[model samples]
Structure formats: structure tokens, C-alpha cells
Target: MKNRNVILTGAGTVIPWGAPSTDKLTDILRQDSIFINDKGEPIGEYLYSLLKTQMGKRRAYNTPNFESILHFIELLFEYKKSRYSMSSSFFRINDFFLIDPEIQNKLEIYESQKLDKRLDTSFGTKRLIANEYYYYELYLHFTFLIKKEIEKYETVEEKYHELNKSFNRFLHQVKGENGIVRFYTLNYDYLVPKISNLKFFDGYDEKTGKMNVKKIIEDDYIDCYYHLHGSFKLNFIGEKSNDYSVCYVQKNFVQNNLIPSNIITGYNKPERILNETFYEFYQKMIEDLIKANKIYIIGYSFNDMHVNAALKRALKKGSAKITVVDKCSLEDFHLKYDKIIDSNPDYDMNKLIKFPNTYQMTTEALKAKAYLNGLNDFLDNLIRSNN
Candidate 1:
């Protein structure tokens, strides 16, 4: 009965479910759109005001590069942090965030060449540290904004109803439900569990109210969920939980100590994944990938190096086939996967691969009658095969 192997979905699969895509989120960030809080204050204006004030107070505004750096940091942090909320920073103490190669490279180059004075000065250091906290605060604001947006979708009911409808239609088409079709996501949106009734596990033992990755693996679970990046509800060590202070999943979020945001973002994503909790989640994903006979990627973009590496390793270790369902062209998709495949040349390049023949379809277009029928048929045939 375990005919079709695994179904891997990215943020794109949820587009029909009311989540923003990568391009849409980027478009939103480029604008000066005003989002209001429950208190009716314009949050975007407030964020800009805070950024300007913080930089000015630290005398970073005097530096020609300050405004540009601030803008870059805001955009960078917002892009990564907003992903989980729509679907979906900080200074670290400056040194913390700067450890990321991309952010660090940008800052060092800006400082060395563009700064009016040597960045080694006490004032420069204060400025860097100040921006760190400013970015962190901005991240908090974004979290609040996402929570507000999710509230607009009839909280959990309507959203989950929609998910169940679409996904059940999908499940009805598959050959068999024998093998567990695990959903491993980089998204932080907390809506997937409500949509499916299958045994949902995300490395945290809800029974104990702690993140025990081993207990998750040891359990006799046929179906398991892995949040490769992290989730909004669970708070990690360094993350700042929005005042909600309660995970949406807990029976009593107020009474129980919720897991913090155990996610990886910004430039430190790969580095943070090395931490114990994330490392466990990632290792387990690779394990599952190897066991799967077929892999179906729905909305994923295949951008993360860590994920790509795991997928490649899984392909090398097993004969699992791949199917990508996204708007990207076959060429583009192949190129992206090739980035993973080319990294390890010894692995066989040929395996059953399929994608949407129609290009440039919106998430809506992709879900249209023609495409959906084609997709369902393709998957059915793939799963029905006894080969």
C-alpha cells in the first residue's frame, strides 16, 4: 500500500492556502506599506522612526554608510523573519550577527571603504551594537505583525478547513497511504498540523513540554514532521518570543514553558543549524530522505544549502525519485537541483523527475483544472507503478 513515497512541499504549495510566496513577500518589503497594530499605531512608520532615532543617538547617522547599512539590515532581517509569518535579526551584540559571512562581508566592506572615520573608534562600535538591537527590535515587530495577519484568516478554523479540503483531494488521488508521507518544511507558519489528522511530530515531545529530539526519533511513528528551519511557536535560546509567551500547540500555553523559536535565519542559518536542537532535526530529515523511495517537492524553492546537501545525500544513498511542483521552468528547476547534484558528482544523475509543463503560472494558475488534472494524473501513475 505504501506506493507513493514522500511528498515534499515548500512555501509555494500553500499559495492557494493564503500564504505569501517569496516574490510577493519581496514586493511587500520594497514598499513603505503601513501596517497598524491593535493599538492603531502605524507599525511601519514606528519602525522607521525607531531606526532613525537609534542610529542618530549612537552617532552612526554621521557616517555616510549608516543609512544604507540600516536599510540593508532591515530588509535582510525582514525577508527571513517574515517568511514564516506570511506563510512565515538583531544585533547581536554586533559580534553575534556579524559572524555570518554575508552580513559580515557587507558591513566590513562598507566600514573599510565608506566610513568617514576608522570603524575601530568607540563611537563606531556603539553604532554597530546599536544597529544590532535595532534589527532585533524590528524582528519583534515583524513577529507581531505576522500574528496579526494570521488572526485575519478566521484564526485556525477557516485556514485549516481550506488546507484539509485541498490536501484531502490530493490524498484521494494517491495510490496508497501505507508509507508515511512526511511533510518537512522550512516555513514557520503554524497551520499544517490543523489541516492533517495524521500522526504529527516535530521533534518536540508535547507530552513533556520540552524539545527532546531523541524521543521523537525513538517513537514508533510511521509519519513524522520536521521543521527544518524552525517554527514561530517554539522559541529557541537566543530568540525573543513575542509577548504571547505561549505556543499555539500547548494545551495550556500560559502554564507550560513554551519552546522558543528554534529556527535558523539571516546569515547564521547554517551555523545555527549546528546547535543541538536544529542539528537533531536536520539529521533526522536526512535519515527520512534516505528511506523514502520517491520524493515530491510541492512549493519548495531548493535555495538552502543545508537542505540541498541533504537532498543530494539522500539521492546518493537511495534510489528515491523526485518531482518538483512549482512555477519555475524545468531548466531553472534542473539548474537549482544540479547545484546540489553537481556538488557530489559520483551520484547517478538520472532518476525519475517531473514538473509542471506549463510555465509562469501563478499559484492559482498552477492549481487550475488543467494543471491540477495533469499533476494528479502524473502522480497517480508514478505511485501506481510497481517498478
Candidate 2:
């Protein structure tokens, strides 16, 4: 039980690999080759204008966050999806609005004859558009920015050789000891896999790339790496309803060479996990928290209440110890998480969130307790003592 070590990583973990922060992403997007919509409108300018209008004149300078902008796009897409789904003879659906212009021209002769009429003026159904194509162009740019940054790892940057080498050594040592470290990451970058020398498994089949969470959960101890948030190669595939017997529903996650995307960023992530693809991963996070003997929370902001609540419950048990691997000082950590810890009568935040006491601190004395290098030492020492 003493050797039960669990690690949770967040967005900051991949910063070393030239991964862009939310603000940095926005900055780069503003200057990068801008994506133009069908109307020859730049995607960023179009979206930013909408975003600026939403914020009102006083807050015009307030740049849009990844969450808010993505949420806005998602809401619009959902509205269009549902709005057109309503069956009615009275309404002429905008289905043809997104059709290829040449194709629309080809079908012009039969426009009135067709029940799903093309929205061209000659047919009496006005060619009204909703900037629907812009939604995809915006999302494509978002995905492109993130993917481009992470792909920088493909080049052997001389500056980070030592860091990657150190990471490999730690992973190799753990592999030699036959101990598994369950890495649950909220980041979508493939940085961890790029440097891992130990055997790795992420439930995606080596030959096919099909992910089966049920199979992953079964092989728990040794081969465990869960993406708590969606990743770059993951995409929504198909829907499966448990309504087979009025029981359950399932949705498929898909990916292809052309559109190797679908990472959950932007607003309402806590609410987004309710979907089938991400739900099981989050459920396992709580179980891992309860089971952990020593938990290492690394580079996380604690902005997610679902994650925070799990940490609170795990600490309330008064058995497991937690060490955050951030540069946040003890007092500041309390100020950041006091509301979450305050509600639980059983929690003594002072005990779990304290100075490293020993000289085992990794980053700074006043900031955070324990880190990867120190953690490797702890596990190695424990293995030696047991032998």
C-alpha cells in the first residue's frame, strides 16, 4: 500500500515542447496565415468581431478565451443542427445553403421539383446563409494551431535533450522495478509518448487505432495510460443507443488522416465530460484518487470542480498524501483551493498541504513539494528497502 503512486498531469506539462498556452495560441493565430471563409472573410476577424460584440464596448480589449470562443462555435453548430432537424412542411430547410455552389447551379433546373430545394433566388427560396462554413474554418484553425505547435517536437531541439533524457531514465527505472505509474493527463499533446522508454499502452490498438475503454480498464495495474480529456487523433465516430432495451446509449470516437483532431478545449469542459467518450475516464479518476497512497498533482490549476471534489474526498479519508508539483507557495495554494477544502469537515488542509519538511523539495523551497526526479528516488528507495 505504501508504494501506491499516482500522477496527474495538466496543460503545463507540455509547455516544454513548445506547446502554446491559451493566450499564446490566440496571439499566434492572429498573425498566422488566416483562414478565409466562403465570403472571403478572415475567420479570426469575423469571429473576433462577434466575440467583441458579445463583450460590449467597455470590454472590447478583453481577448476571448479558448473556452468562450469554442463554446460559442459549439453552441451555434448545435443550434443549426437542432434547428434544421425539426420536420415541417411550412419551413424550407437551409440544407442546400452549405452545398457546393457549382452543384447548386447544376441542380437549378430541378430546384422547384425537388422537395429539398436549393436556396437560390430563381427558385423563390431565398439563398439565405448562416456563416455555417465559418464554424468549421474556425475550428480547423484552432486544431491547426495546436497541432503545429506540438509537432515542433519532431525536430531535435538541442536545448531539451537533457530534459528528455532525464525523463527516459525515470521511466526506464520504473519499468525495471515492475511497478506501473498510472499517468492520467488532461493535455492532448503526444509529448509523453515521444519520450517514453518504458512500455506504453493507451487503449488504442497498435495495428488499428481503435480505442476500447472497457479493455483498458481491465488491464489496470501495468499497462495504464488514460487521456482524461480528448486528444488530437480522437474524433467522434458513430452513435450507439442503449435504447436497444430502453437501457443505454453509446457514441463512437473516430479519427482519419485528413482530420486528425478532436481535443476538448474551450469552455464547459466539466459539462462536456458527460458524453460517452470521456465519461469513463473521469469516473476512473475519482477511483484512482481514492486508491492513491501518494498522489502527485502536476501543473494543474484546480479550475475544474469535478476534479477538485475528487481531491477533496480523497484527502478527507486521511490516508493518502498529496504533493502538488507546481511552483505555487503553500500559502498561495491554500488561497487557491480553500473553498474546496473548507467544505469537508473531515479535511485538515494544513496536514496534506504543508512544507516538504525534508530536503526532498524539487523546484523551490517555498513553492510546491516533490517532483519527477525526487519521485523516482522515493520509489527506488522503497524497492531497495523491500528487497
Candidate 3:
């Protein structure tokens, strides 16, 4: 049976209130005071308070440093759980965290030192005592030294949460045969999974290497999350000795030992199919989406050439209809198309083979229209008819 599908896109299309318009997003991104503390103080003031409390001294706190990075990460995770998960089915996005190069290099140095073997009990104790100061020093170095410029109107966390909720609703409303709904995101954040509470089927048996899909029964909502860009919580094989080891950026420091390269920041494209496990799973997601009756896109711009190529390949073989939900106009879509066509003339633009059966709608107009149009009823009927 054909499954009804909807895709929402924008900076924060899933927020309960609705995805902010492009103008609103632009304004928010431009503001410096957007990052606020729990008590509604500016981030700078909050950092000063924290430093005074910790160091017992009053000093000029630096902006664009590790302090802000840690604050941003903490605030991001905190907000996701609170504001984004009221009624969404699941939230998952591609790579969310982009680690800085300086931080990556430091982590690499620490990892190289611990390479040969697991530290013995005695060595572990001594190493902690010896490097405790250095660890904190490294923490401060990154926190105080690294500078991150705020985007003119972007609150990455806020937008992410908003979009997550919207997408969840869209997916949750899907009802039909046991057809699959797949999300492929270029983002590296965990907002989607966190907001939707969907588990990423990593295809591993806890007891064995045999891979399997975590099944969902009929009438169950289990949308597949494929992170084409990786994730913040992802860990490399053999990176940590114990399965229970928790890795997180506590305050400003990574609490667990992890190499910098594993963090997946910088401009580096992830190695294609790093392992057998990931390759099979990724291939399956692409295949499933291609075979589905409909494909909905939200938030992603299809800017990456590699991803665009993959989509083209999938469309060539699939009969699925494509709906691209973005904040762009028909003119904007044409401009993007012209650019793509210019670069890849071999792509059949005349036949519409690559982009035929595609639809585009502005996010703001869609929301207002959805309200007036009673989207829930429409979606329910669509699902029923399609199935």
C-alpha cells in the first residue's frame, strides 16, 4: 500500500508554535542577546557569575570561547527535551555538532598517548593524579581560547527543536500498511531522535555481531532516522573500552576519553561506509526511501553535491513522488535548478526524470494554509486513500 507522506523544511519547522518565517529566523540570528541564561540574563553575565563562583575572583570573561561552546551545548540539550516533544512521533537529524579544529587536535594528542593498551588500575590512578590539572587546563584552553562567532539570526538549538516537533507531527499522523518512513538529514544534531524518542537501529546485537532491524508492529509509528552526516552522540569502534562509558561535554570538557577525529567536526566529509555495519544500514535506508510511495524533505537544502547525486540516482529508479518543503519560492527553486543543471548537464532536465512529480511550498504559507485547511483531517484522509 502507498503511504501518505509530508516533509517540512526550514530552520525550525517543527516547533509547536510553527516554524519561524525566514525573516523571523534572520532577525533572531542577527541578535547578540539571544543566548540567555536560565534566569534570563545574557550569556556574558552568566559566564562571569560562573567564573567568579568557580575561581573566587572577578575577571574579564572572554566571548567566543569554550565557555560559550559548553553553554551552547548544555542549553541545546536542555531545551530539546523541554519544548520540542509534546506530540511528535520521532525526531532525528544528520550530523548536528561541528567540532572545531583546535579542539580536535587537542583530543588527538590525548588519544595518541593512551593507544597501546588499557591502563592498569595502578597506572590509571597515577595518571589521573598527574594529569588532573592538565585536563582542566585543556578544558579552559578550549573554552577560553576558542572563539565562535554568533550567526546573525540563528539560534541553532531553538530552530532545531522547533523543526523537530513539526516533523514528528507529520510522521506521527501517518497511518497505513507497515510501510516505512525514512528521514535522511545532513545535520549532525540529535534533536530529531531526542524530540521524537525514536531509537536509531544501529543493527548490532548486544550479545552478537549478527545485525538486525529493531522491528515495529503494525499500527506502530517507527520512522527510520538515517544520519547521512553522523551525530553528536556517535562513538567510533574501539574508541572506548567499556560499553557503559559515558561521553559528554561536561561544563566545557569532554568527560570521557575520545579522540578528536571521532568528534566529526571541521570540513571533513565522513569516510564513505566506514564499516560493514554502517554501509549495509545506510544502503538499506536509501533503498527503502527510493521504494516508498512518497518522500518528504524538511530543513535540508540539498546543497551537498554528493547527497544531490544520490537523490538523483534514487529518483531515476523510484516511482515515488517528491515533495520539497522549503522557505523558497518557485523562482528560487528554478534558480537552484539552473545552478544544478549548469554544473551537471548530463542530468536530463528536459525529461524531468530527476525532478518530475516534485512539489514545492513556502513554509509560512503552508502553515497558515494548513490551519485554514485543517491539515490533520486532510492528512488522515490522504493516508486512508493511499493505503
- Local error of candidate 1 at 306, Å? 0.1
Q: Per-residue alpha-carbon lDDT of model 3 for 140-217, expressed as tens digits?
A: 222211111111222335645534554455566542345445555554334455566445443334465333445411
Cα lDDT of candidate 3 equals 0.37
Task: Provide the TM-score for each candidate, comma-separated.
Answer: 0.58, 0.64, 0.42
True-structure lDDT of candidate 1: 0.48
Whole-model lDDT, candidate 2? 0.53
The Cα RMSD of model 3 versus the native structure comes to: 15.7
Q: After superposition, how far is residue 303 of candidate 2 from its true place, in Å?
A: 1.6
Q: Residue 200's C-alpha lDDT in candidate 3?
A: 45
In model 3, state the lDDT of residue 280. Answer: 47
> Local distance difference test, per candidate?
0.48, 0.53, 0.37
Cα lDDT tens digits, model 2, 1-387, are 224556787775665556677677665554443444344444454444456555674454346765555555544344334445422332221121222344234223222221212322110122122333444334545655665665675345778776677666655553445456767888766677767765667767666565667666776666356777766555443112111112122222321011112555655565557644667778877877788766667677677677778877777765666666544556655555564564444343443423343223433322224433333344444445457
Clashes of 1: 14
| Candidate with best TM-score | 2
Off by over 4 Å in 1: 1-4, 27-132, 150-163, 172-177, 238-262, 343-387
